[model samples]
Target: MNIKPLFDRVVVESVQSEEKTKSGFILPSSAQEKPQTARVVAVGPGGVVDGKDVTMEVKIGDVVLYAKYSGSEFKVDGKEFTILRQSDILAIVE
Candidate 1:
């Protein structure tokens, strides 16, 4: 299935978090932190939003960082994804 966002909304899939720490200590799933990074799946067209002009800075396949508890999460075709406004995305990963 394909996802298409609208009105400055973006669809992103969460990147898998590392199971081991930098020190080589393995962490259990319950103890691992939720990943804040995600890969852009779909991007909305930039336009006026909330009485202001909004421009999308990220594109599909771009990796980005977002707020810890922002956006709405859902699943499609057994794959999990998050949909959020472009402003909700903090920074695009280089």
Candidate 2:
């Protein structure tokens, strides 16, 4: 499905958490931790600030780091998605 964000909001697809440990020990899905990383899917044009428009620092396809509990979850085309404000994104990864 086609999705678009508005006014500094961003849509993201969560990166799945690893199913195994660094040592190659497999972990059950119930024991796995939620992922804090995500890929930007859609981004809003900008946010209003002091009557002026403040452009977002992130763009579509940017990988970003966010707080574990920062966004709201939803599903699109049977795939899970997250909606969050720009402030919730911690950093953009290279």
Q: State the local distance difference test value for candidate 1.
A: 0.92
Which segments of candidate 2 are over 4 A away from where they belong?
49-52
What tens digits encode model 1's per-residue C-alpha lDDT throughout 16-92? 99999999999999998878999999999979899999988999999999998989999999999999988889999
Model 1: runs farther than 4 Å from truth?
none
Candidate 2 on 1-94: residue-level lDDT in tens?
A: 6998878889999878778899999999788887889999999888695687778999889999998898899998899999998889999989
Best by TM-score: 1
lDDT of each: 0.92, 0.89
In candidate 2, position 87 carries an lDDT of 85
* Best-performing candidate as measured by lDDT: 1
TM-score of 1: 0.92
